[model samples]
Target: MSSPASGHPSPPRRGPRIAAISATIALFVAMIGIATSTQASAAPGCKVDYSTSNWGGGGFTGSVKITNVGDAITGGWTLRFAFPGSQTISQGWSATWAQSGTGVTATSMSWNGNLGAGASVDIGFNGTYSGTNASPTSFSLNNVTCTGQPGTTTTTTTTTTTTTPGGPGPGNRVDNPYVGAKVYVNPDWSAKAAAESGGSRISNQPTAVWLDRIAAINGTTSARGLVAHLDEAVRQAAGSTLTIQLVIYNLPGRDCSALASNGELGATEIDRYKTEYIDPIAAILGRSAYANLRIVTVVEIDSLPNLITNVSPRPTSTPNCDVMKANGNYVTGVGYALAKLGAVANVYNYIDIGHHGWLGWDDNFGPTAELLYTAANASGSTKANVHGFIANTANYGATTEPYFKVGDTVGGQPIREKAKWIDYNKYVDELSYAQAFRQRAVQAGFDSGVGMLIDTSRNGWGGTARPTGPGPTTSPDAYVDGGRIDRRIHLGNWCNQKGAGLGARPTAAPASGIDAYVWVKPPGESDGASKEIPNEEGKGFDRMCDPTYTGNARNGNSMSGALPDAPLSGAWFSAQFQELMKNAYPAL
Candidate 1:
């Protein structure tokens, strides 16, 4: 979690002003070099000056300066180099390199080698580069440096090691690969279910459902007890050494914009969140039964629109559109709350990335990163407090046809600029923007390894197809793919639906830069609504059936709204829970 070195060179500036200035200088320099040169034989060989530095997150940046030392000549040549560290080169370009522990070797691409004599070329490498940047005692061309020849240019490699004073050591685990699941207590019905079915009935309910039921069962006592039971259930369902993703969704004013009745959380309301919601959850997690749990706090629930706008300075007439913007101080507030609850130790706080439509190009890249950085630091949380940014909790995956452009009747058409506000085309389609933001974070000393957990829960049939373009390709619409959105992978409820029985599990090995594919949201359960209307208001099946139902038909009916009359049926609830385990973690 340490920051990058201070004296590192700034990244090359892009866009109009900078590009124009660079062009002018390049033209003038070319003219002078051409005038001063006469014969091609007098052209000097290329000179390479290289340097590297570590940034502590298994990442590093390296710069290579290639200068033409001979008489004026046109064309490029390759520059070769090596790395002496223990890090995997996650990404690289303009040059190719391979790594083996403390030894890394690289050769420049064909195009990079074509440089005019007396002219200079600068190239950079950014990715998972590690170790000290001490000057390599020896370097060679093909195998040997130029010697015994006048005007003979030799490859000169210089290494400057820069170490940032303070940062987290390698021992600290700060990343969460799992997509989180909802967990909260429903006082009224949970108590009723617990009383009617006994402990067995209570244990059979889904995690959030059971917790709510327990709260109602014996008031605070049931609340405390439910935590233990939930832990046991998860352990049994996901293996003893399992890493589970638990989402704490009791934020006072969750999704205030979507539902006016939800109300917003003011100063006093935040205090209550710490007491009633955060404290109890922390206590439950603190219990010995759940000792192996790794928690991640995903700020806000259901995309609270304009959350950021409320606190950020804005004109009275112009409201900020981003929720996190309004609540610019929420990250600090949550950090303070977590510190007080003694829960920060086990939690990796992640602020939502919101849907592609919400954030624009520049704002998404620069300002968002600054906000996250400020929030973490102000909250008394270091880089260690955060794992990385996450994208789309319960939303669509990447697709080809621009979803934002598809109107009611029109399928494919050039989108108007006005619609650009909500158009995801400007944001989602640009992978370089995401990369630039991540690179900026790296430059600012934050970990560049980002994670995007697509909501694969209900996006199966409705998912967008893959995207294809120039630079690194990412899904234009959110969907599960093997490309690295850093440690790329998909976390959902079920996998390979057509394969083995209902409970069959899938593999976790990374495909396409993705490290693991996991099931964060347990399948076979309702998405908190009837099947007909996925978002309809209802207490879900747990509220209607016996707290112990363990059949698929009942669970499926409840999820699909086929069993509206039997919301808390025990048999129905048990069936859904059992089916989830069967489908999500069959190995367990």
Candidate 2:
């Protein structure tokens, strides 16, 4: 949901890295002692190092490193263990997991089947527990017991303290990068914002740097290249911990469902995307010079969601979308990006999931989770590669609809059922959708510790026209239309919305399951040109960006609600900037 569609020439970079650094220090690593039991006789020998990050609420993520101390199990091997308490495995990765009663078995995958002597493989799982969550005292590799150091048993407890913000600390991979850290302000965005009237209020905020095209990797005439941004981030850090956000867009045949923001790469040009796009970015990110910074990469917005909602068999299907789905390029490209970027220790990958309005229905919700899971495990990637997800990027879904709930009734019917705008969708805003999606993601095999981010750059629907109270209950449509904070003519209208405002200021840990509320979309950037003004950026004019756009099936045949006289996507629009400031929810 970014501006400049295909070639995202640097937008306003508005999202500040508002990460919440927890005052309460988290116990990162807990190591337990194991006593060898008779079960050890079944196999040669092994050592398993198990650790977990407990987020409380009965959820925890476990990381296990299995080292074969004895003979190599050539063909395949199954690591078995039992929970000492009421723990239940909900999702796992790096190996195939199955549980029965208290016993659990993890079989090696095809790629990691053979184990040479002294070799080790790391695997993990997300689990829930009741009562007490205790670590397993023993594990068996290939049915043989894992006995360490001939009866010399000991336990290790490691505590990490938040160091003064600077380069990488002892625990480089903090549970939440935004926590206990300062966000890097993109000077490029700051300079532009400072030039706007009253834009200085947010000029210093951290916004994401979008590498929307191959040329964006290097410096475009209009924008700084990836290396330049990283170098600047290092300088910004000085000697403190800082977080930088980057949007890794540009999948082959990108934005297949929409004409605007169409990318340069062809459907079959997967190799070029890998080598030319992702590889260069990954290389720059992996450099030790910038190792101390926390880099958050928002992987491909508008790619996967289209596969479910706009492909063949759906009335809204597009021929280009069908081709993208058939070739599996979107899936392959996202997986490839996740693998490459995630390989960098400091990089955290948050895949983009379209707003609630786009996938809040029963059919779209579960399928989207499954599809995301597939992508996380595709292209030599694993669930471990994903850090979390971001929602409502470059869209106008409110952070919350305060006046009423979806379950509220009007005329004896659920508001969702009665309201023309909601149209039976479960969620009415981005925050609710993001939290719910996190649960679905964990159930779909992602880490339970995964957090969520919401792009609040332009969804704040505050202004004189803002609703003060719940709409009248005379009927569903009136109730929803009157009080709903999201003032878009239709839930599907996502371009430069007419009455949009700056949403919540970027902040850390604003809500449960949310890591931060970011300005990933860079408010004030045109979503797409209101009318076709051809250029070299690969952006096409879509009617959805037109002020008088009649309707589209995707938007329930409603008005586009976009502002008029907008420039190409990603190009700065001073008029939109003034509007965002004037209408900011928290008030500038």
Winner by TM-score: 2
Per-model TM-score, in order, reads 0.45, 0.74
Per-residue lDDT tens digits for candidate 1, residues 1-588, read: 000000000111121110000001111111111112332233234455655544434445555555655555333233333444444565453444565664555543332333455556555565553344444433333323433222433232322122232112122333333323322223323444344423333323322222222132123532334454455445554643333444444344343322211223442366666666556666765665655444444554333223432223422112322444445435545555335333434444454544343333334445556656665565555655555444333332331223332111112222221121223223332222232344445445554343333323212222121223221223322221222121112111111111111211212212211112322233333232221222222122222122222323211222211223222111133333333233221223
Say what the RMSD of model 2 is.
13.0
Give candidate 2's error at residue 358 in angstroms. 0.2
Worst 10 residues of 1 by lDDT: 1-10
* lDDT scores of the candidates, listed in order: 0.34, 0.77
> Model 2 misses residue 85 by how many Å?
26
Clashes of each: 64, 19
Model 1 residue runs over 4 Å out of place are 1-226, 237-240, 260-267, 302-305, 308-329, 337-346, 399-445, 448-452, 462-588
lDDT (tens digit, per residue) of candidate 2 on 273-343 = 99999999999999999999999989999899889888878878889989999999999999999899888
